[model samples]
Target: MRRIVQFSTGNVGRHSLRAVIGRPDLELVGVHASSPAKIGRDAAELCDWSEPTGVIATDDIDALIGLRPDCVVYTALAETRPMEALEQLTQILAAGINVVGTSFVWLAAPRYAGDWVREPLEKACAAGGSSLYINGVDPGYSGDTLVHTALSLATRVDSITVQEIFDYANYDDAEYTGAAMGFGVAEDEELPPLFLPGVVESMWGGPVRALADGLGIVLDEVRQRTERWFTPERIDCTMMTVLPGQMAAVRFAAEGVLDGEPVITVEHVNRLTAAAAPGWIFPPDGHVGVHRVVIEGDPRVEINTHVSHPLLDPTDAACISTAARVVNAIEWVCNAPNGIIAVEDIPQAAIMNGLMWRAK
Candidate 1:
C-alpha cells in the first residue's frame, strides 16, 4: 500500500477523502485542510464515518510536506487560486511526492501548459524525480479519456465532438455558478470569466490537444464559439436563484481545427435549470448531468455517459467519478517516469484491489 496525504477536503477533496479511506491499497498518512474549524478534526469524522482515524487535519502546509508521503492528492481549488496553487504544487513536487489531482488543469497536457506554469513544475519533477498528473470529470474521464477510448473502434475519423450538457440546479455553489460561469447574470452584462477569451482555450483546449495528438492530427488553430440564454422566469436551484432575464444558460464550443475543419472539439451546455436550454442535448433519463461524445467518420457513433449514485445527485456523482479517476491512477502515476503525465500515457487504469476481476 502507498502512503498518501490529501491536500484539501473541499467539494472534490471530500469525495477523495472517502475514497482513500475505503481503498485498501492506500494508507492515509495525513490530511490538510485550510479552514480553522477543520483543523484537528479526525479524518474519519470529516468524511462522516463512525470510526475514528488517528490522522488529525492541520492548517499548516509545512507540516503536510514534512509527512513526506509517497503521493499527495492535491485537489485544492486551482482556478480560484492559480498562482498560489502553482506555488503549492511546486513545493510539493520539489519535495518528491508523486502528485495527482485536478489542481493543475493544463498539466493534463503539459505540452500546452504555459512556460511560466509548466517550467517550474517540470524543473521540480526533474529535481525530485517525481511525476504529476492533473485531470477531472469534464476535461478528464468523460471528455478526453472517453473520446480516446471511443476512437479505438473507428476505421477512419473526420470529426470528434465531445459535449457536457447538464443543469447546475443541484450544484449549489453560488460563487461558481453565478460569478465564475455567469449562470445568473443580466442579459446585458458582458461575458463572464467562463466565456472570457483564452479561458476556454486554457482549460478545455488541453483535451482538444490530447485528442488531436492521439489521432495524429495537427490542429491548424483553435477557436471558440459561444451562445448565452436568459431565463424567461425566476429559476430556483438547490442553493441559488436566477431572476427573469438573467443569464440562465451558456453553450460554448472550443474547437481545434485541422485543414480548415474542426477535427477535435469540446463543448459545454451549462445551465441554471434543465428547462433553460431546450435546444441542447439531454439524457433520456433526465439526470442532472450527462457527458456525450460524437465521432463522425466511417463508423459514425455517439455515446453518452451518466455517473451517479443512490445517495448523490448527478453533480456530486460527477465529483465522485473525478475523484475515483485520480485515486485509481495513483499506482500507475507513482511508478511512472519523472515528468508530467496524461490519461493516454497510462494504461486502462482499472480500479485497484479485487473490486473487479476477470474470469480465467
Candidate 2:
C-alpha cells in the first residue's frame, strides 16, 4: 500500500482525506490543514468519520514532509493563491515525495501555464527525483480526459467544445463566489478576476492548448469571452447572497482559434441559482452540475456527464469526483519517473483500477 498525505481540509480536501483513509491500497499517513481549529484535530473529525484513523492534521509542511509519504493529495484552494500553492508543491516535490492534487489549475496544461509556473516545479522535481500530477473534474477529466475520449469516435473532426453547466450557489465558498467569480456584483462594477483579460486564458487555456497539442494542430491564438446575467430577485445560497440586479450568472469560454475558427474551446455556464439563467445551457436533469463535451465532425459526438452523490449536493459531489481524479492516480504517479507527469503519461489500465470492484 502506498502511504498518502492529504493536504488541506476544504471541500475537495475533505473528500480526498476520506478517500485515502477508506481505500485499502492506500494508507493515510499525514494531513496538512491550514485552519487553526483543524490543525490539531483527528482526520476523522474533519471528514465526519466515526472512528479515528490515528492520523492528525497539522499545518507544518516540514512535519508532513518528514512523514515521507509516497504521495501528497493536494486539494488546497489554488485559484485564489496560485503562487503560494505552487511554492508549496515545489517544497513537497523537493522533499522527494510525489504529489497528485487539484490545487495547480494551470499545471493541468503546463505548456500554456507560462514559464513562471512551470520552471520551479521542473527544477524541484529534478532535484528531489519526485513527480507531480494535477487533475480535476473540469480541467482534469471533462476538458482533456473526457473530451479526448469522445474524440476517439470521430472519423472527421471539425471543432471541439467542453462546457461546464452548473449552479454556483451550491458551491460553499463565499470569497470564491463573491470575489473570484464576480457573483452578486453591480452592473457598473469592474469585472472579477475570473473574467478579466488573460485570467481565463491562464486558468482554462490549459485544456485548450492540450487539445490543440493532441490534435497535432497549432492554434493561432487563444481568445476569451464572457457575459453575465443579473438576477431580478434576491437569492441566497449556502455561501453568499445575491441581491436583485446583481450579477448572478456567467457564461464564458476560452477558445483555441486556428485560421480564425475556434477549433478547440472550453466554456463554462454558471448560475447562482438554476432559475437565474433560463436561457443558458443546463443538464438534462436541469437541476445541478453537468459537464458537456461536444464534437462537431462527420460523426458528431456530444456527451453530458452528470455527477451526483447520495448524501452531498451536486456541487460537492463534483468535488468528490475531482478528488477521485487525482486520488486514484496516486499509485501511477508514485510509480512514474520523477517530473511533472501528465495525464498522457499514465496508462488507462493503471488509472482505471478500483472502479470495477468495491472493497469491503
Candidate 3:
C-alpha cells in the first residue's frame, strides 16, 4: 500500500482524508497542521471521525518527513501566500516524496506561472526524483475536464462554453463567499484579482486555447470581464442574511480568440442573493446551489446539469469533489511525462476511473 500524509484538516482536507482512509490501496500514515490546537490530536478525532486513529497531527515538518511516507497530499488554503507552501512542497519533493496538491493553480499551466514559483518547484522535483501534480474541481476539473468532455461529442467544433451557476448564500464566511463570487472592495479581502480573472484564466485558459489549437485555430488574445450585483435590502437564507448591498452576485467571463474572433468562452457565476434574471433561481429545489455545463458546438450538445444536494452544501461538495479527483489521479500523474499538464492530457480511462472511484 502506498503511504500518504495529508497536510490540512480543513473542509477539503478532511473530505480527502475520509476518502483516503476508505481506500484499500492506500494507507493514511500521518497528518500535518499549522494550528497549535490540533498538533497532538488524533487525525480521526480532528476530522470528527467516529473513532481515533493513532495518527497524530504535527506542526514539525522534519518529524513528518522522518516518517518517510511515499506521498503528501497538500490541500491548504488557496489564498494564503503560496511561496511558503511552494517551498514546503519543494522540501517534500526534495525528500523524494511525490506531491499531489490542490494549491498552485499554475501547475495546470507552467508557462503562465512566473519564474519565481515554477522554476524552484520543478528543480526540487527533478532533483529529488519526485513528481508533483496540482488539480481541483473549479479550475482543474470543471473548467478543463468538463470542457474536454463536452468536446468529445463534437463532430465539427466552432466554440466551447462551460458555465457554473450556484447560490453562494450558504457560505458564512464573507471573505470566502466574496472570493468565490469575485467581490474585491475591502483592503483585508483575500478575494483578489487572481481568483477573479488572472488565476481563473491561467487555469482554464490553457485548456481552451489547447482546444482551439487542436482545431487548427490560431489564437490571438484572451480577455476577461467581471460583473457584480447587489441587493438594496438585506435578505435571509435558511440561516442568516449575508449583508445588505454587499456583493450579492458576481460573474467572471473569460473568452479565448483566434484572430480576434471568439473560439472558446468559459463563464463562472456565483449568486448569493435571490435571482434577478429569468431561469436563475437560488436554492432551487431547496438546495444551496446548482451547477450546469452547457457546450455550444457545430451541431450543439450538452450534458449533465449536476445540481447540489439539499442534504449536502454545494461549495463544500465542489471543493471536496475537486480534491478527490486530483488525489485519485496521483498515480497517473506520477507516471506521465512532466512539464505542465491539463486534464485533457490525462487518459480517458484514468479520468473515468477517478470519477468512478469518487462515486464509489
Which has the greatest TM-score? 2
* Runs of candidate 3 exceeding 4 Å displacement: 177-200, 236-241, 275-291, 305-311, 334-341, 351-360
Ten-residue stretch with the least lDDT total in model 2: 351-360
lDDT of all predictions, in order shown?
Answer: 0.82, 0.86, 0.68
Q: Which 10 residues in a row give candidate 3 its minimum summed lDDT?
A: 275-284
lDDT digits (tens) for residues 35-90 of candidate 1: 88898999987877667879999978788889889999989878878899988888
Clashes of each: 0, 0, 0
Question: Which scores higher on TM-score, 1 or 3?
Answer: 1
Better of 1 and 2 by lDDT: 2
- Evaluate model 3: give its lDDT: 0.68
Q: Is candidate 1 or candidate 2 better by TM-score?
A: 2
User: TM-scores of all models?
Assistant: 0.94, 0.96, 0.85
lDDT, model 3, position 297: 62
Alpha carbon lDDT at 208, candidate 1? 82
Output the number of the lDDT-best candidate. 2
